[model samples]
Target chain A: MSEKIDRRMLLKATAAVLGAMPLAGCDLASQDPTVRGILDSAEELTEAAQRTLLSRQSLAREFPETAISKHFRANGSDNPDDGDYQRLARSGFADWRLDVGGLVDHPLRLSLTDLRAMPSRTQITRHDCVEGWSCIGKWTGVPLGGVLQQAGLKANARYIVFYCADTFGDSLDLPNKYYESIDLVDAFHPQTILAYDMNGKPLEVPYGAPLRVRVERQLGYKMAKYVMRIEAVESFGHIGGGRGSFWADRGYEWYAGI
Target chain B: MVRATHWIGVVCVTILLLSGLQIFNAHPALYLGMDSDFAHPAASIGVAQRGERKIGVTTVFGRSFDTTGLLGVSGRNDAAERAFPAWATLPGYQDLATGRRWHFFFAWLLVLDGLAYLVFSLASGHVWRDLIPPARQLRRIGASVLDHLRLRFPRGEEARSYNVLQRLSYLAVIFVIAPLLVLTGLTMSPALDAVFPFVAPLLGGRQTARTIHFICAFLLLGFALVHVAMVLLSGVWNNMRSMITGWYRIKPEGSLHVGEN
Candidate 1:
């Protein structure tokens, strides 16, 4: 293993030194138009490489019981602080309903009991935040694929957009309401779930109570918290800022597999 | 070829550093353990305001230091606190998404460029002949370090060949730091975690990998600074020309090169 690592390092160093060779002679490649074009297309190239390495169904690592962190620090909007969310939380989320609408054959509204009664899965997985932190917890909820199957996604549907109750930047406006989206490839992944339980108990408000979508393969931000609805859409063109998610709309990469 | 690669490295590394700092500011804390808490961090750096003044604070293992103006406090009159100023970051704003895009895009270029450099250097025997110090230089490596410290540099034929310190530093950056940075970076991704599960434990966990990544980046930066200083002191025109046109005007013997220790 050590020898292999050494060989790899040698190759990389050699390549980096060799990589510089073209710059001395190729003025055309250095041109702004050509460089911009390469940068634009590089995203797809990287995405393809990652997907090719791991199958879509590949499972994220699951930790042992003892590995769970004592304190999984709350990030972004820990609490909605809105009247509707507060009311639902006070009433044990009995009145809360998950509106599954948009480009689906059957638009269903599911209560927490209905979701719990459905076939479920529980797995201990790590939540990797883009901000460079991680936490492990056991999540229990129904698979998002199962729910989507029940709702019967329309043939044209290209994305699964999760609408959440949490609002950002001191506004309850539509644009501020936190929303995230995932394509069908991720939507149907076996590990993807709408979790209601955390670490053998009900999820606390700070950790997205009632329910949240867990796209385990992506970063924590992709796991839309405080989810109130799931919408199957052909495209996210009309979504806030025409970007797939709230953070994506701001400046984050919509495909945050890293 | 060498000059082109060196300059590309310069631009990419600059983008990586500024954008990376911005990304670090988002959380502004690092931990060594398997798990972490807000109440205590192994190390934390952030900004706060006190009575019309903004302060950048860095706390390491419970000890705090005031970083202030340089970090945590923006130069703008509004006094809004940000960990790193906008100018240093890629988009010149507190946008992680854009910062990441810039970081990743340039990261690929750097790696690809590295690969090309490696293949070419090996084929040309540049690695063994030029980069690796000759066996005789090994015995006199101590003198090389002392000379560097004393601000003395080689001239004439000696100047054309890299000294022991130059060879070692360049080799370390190429063979150690760059690869480690890429591997540690991959370790942080959940998708890659699925593919290479052993990386986490091997590197002591994702957080540890992140800390190491930061450390490696700073080391690279330090190398760059020293490299530029060496270039300027040695002979900026000659050095720049050597990299650009691949023609170095070697000083004649007994030219009396100035030494700055």
Candidate 2:
């Protein structure tokens, strides 16, 4: 029977399979939670494979004397809607003392001015946002590693979590926390500055002013803006749904190492 | 109708790739916020002292980094810089201009084709019946997906039509990646922006959208790679014919390695 199959039948079979590739492609990319969850899981494997294939990447190059884009737009929330933030904004972020606590012996609450007083590092590296944009800018700030050292992280700490002032509410059950997490690896990178300044100017409120993360290895979103408090933890489990950040908690891959 | 729908989808994908690569290759200025939405992480870095000078920045930030030539072999730099994007092809003289022309000229076709495809798909039962797997399959599909990654299991359900994985991936390209690509293109274009008042803010900004567009292409490209691989595995001749002629018959009698449901 197999050998006797008609040519038309064979052609129909071929047509069916060939014709369905795009449909197959569409099927793999649906949004039903089950389909989404299934796709999301498989998608991670591909991402991991690609990551392995392209591991040990040298940081992207920085050109000499390139003009920093005239404007570096904010990627996330501009002004946080939280009550404390609204009141703080009314006073112009003056009374605001960034609390650096949790898993540290000597927790620190330094004023924005006090942070500026510390020795600062300046670099002309370009900022890459996860959204398809790049801008070369001179970021000036105290190295974040320096600030962590001042706060004195305890021996057990492994991950650091940043709690933000903004919330993008979608899941009613889930807390609306705009947060991000990074391990000790990125926490210590040289260009991983806690950017207080951009383009030789103080970071405006929109671009994560007063303090935002610059995990230069990953995309710009890893650089959280409007930083309110930073906590050092042994594990990420209790940190806002455990995936790390707001997006991470949703369906986003945790590493975001890209 | 499905035949016409299929052609439109193919055309749309082709048009999208042409225009997308053009916009990418054009080196349009990508700003900071248009292309992405991640914005959390405030863990700080600290200091380490080797000598009186204290050479390296220490551990407050909770992210990895390295120093440049100033420190040389002693330090490392993170790979996030945009000196050259992963998607930018090194086009030759002959195809470069044509690629860009085809990209810009056919940009509308991709947009229109995609819109039409979406509308048609919604009207057809195919989207609900095949693409979006039923509630029961969702749990297993999710679990099977995890199992596939660990290599403990590399299978998912094998339906005559689209499976769970195929359906979801298509959804992502259509909704997440495609719209993002379109928005980013619009952001890079001044003429378009002039026509659309809220496009920039609707997408955060032109720069953000630009970055979003590029990353989304990579996702699409990834999907295409797996699509080809699946065709070869499932039987290339059969798959190709199905796409070209819009008819597919189940192979008479070969053992199918159905993916775990």
Candidate 2 ranges with C-alpha deviation above 4 Å: A1-29, A32-38, A41-60, A169-171, B1-261
lDDT by candidate, in order shown: 0.82, 0.60
What lDDT tens digits, residue by residue, belong to model 1 across residues A169-236?
65444488889999998999999999999999998999999898888888899998899999999999
Candidate with top lDDT is: 1
lDDT of 1 at B166: 93
What are the per-residue Cα lDDT tens digits for candidate 1 across B182-239?
9988888888988888888889888888888888999998999999999898889999
In candidate 1 chain A, what residue range of length 10 has the lowest lDDT sum? A22-31
Please identify model 1 stretches exceeding 4 Å from their true place: A1-42, A170-174, B48-54, B74-80, B255-261
Worst 10 residues of 2 chain B by lDDT: B36-45
User: Residue A181's C-alpha lDDT in candidate 1?
Assistant: 99
